[model samples]
Target: MPKSLAEVEEGRTVRIVDVVAGRGAAAMLYNLGLRPGARVEVIRSGPGPVVVRTEGGTFSIGRGLAFKVLVEEEE
Candidate 1:
């Protein structure tokens, strides 16, 4: 059930399963708390940065960074 963040619809809860970390990608996602095993809820996307609400707070993860984080939709 793992899918790239770009494949996930906004307003759904997803569990972070993997990350394709790179220099910019790592810092972007890490700053937004998108590491493996982290639970994130996709809030709003498109025409702007993809937003994710997590334990710490609401964070806007850009599509470029979002694509690197693989997540499974929560049931």
Candidate 2:
């Protein structure tokens, strides 16, 4: 099942399914190398920013924004 980035477990890799954030937030994430089809590894998850690693680099997404990024586990 698809889950929000904020809900992904640490050490798991997931593919971005959709970003439900506002235009500004979505644009910001896009610039940060997060978008549909991008593969990201969850480095941390919980009551703080969600840290994810992508080919571009690592980034810490605020909890609110992280919840807006929907993802699915990669096979």
Candidate 3:
């Protein structure tokens, strides 16, 4: 099942499935190396921004944007 990135726990790796946001938000996330098919490791997910590591680099995405990023946990 697909879940928002913000809900993913630390140490878990997930594949981005979709981004439910406007063009600007989507573009911003894409520029940050987050897009459908991309894989990200949850570095930190808590009260603050959710931090993730991708093939490009590590980044901190605010909870708002993180909620728009849908992903499936990787085995």
Best-fitting candidate, scored by TM-score: 2
For all candidates, the clash counts are 0, 0, 0
TM-score of each: 0.82, 0.96, 0.95
Residues 1-75 of candidate 1: C-alpha lDDT, one tens digit per residue: 688887788789999998886877777667767778889888897666788889989887777777878889888
Clashing residue pairs in candidate 1, if any? none
Q: To one decimal, what is the Cα RMSD in angstroms of model 1 from the true structure?
A: 1.8
RMSD to true structure for each model, in Å: 1.8, 0.7, 0.8
**lDDT for each residue of candidate 3 in 17-48, tens digit (9 for 90 to 100):** 99999999999988877999999999999998
Candidate 1 residues lying further than 4 Å off, grouped into runs, are none
Give the candidates in order of lDDT, highest first.
3, 2, 1
lDDT-best of 1 and 2 = 2
- The weakest ten consecutive residues by lDDT in model 2 span 24-33
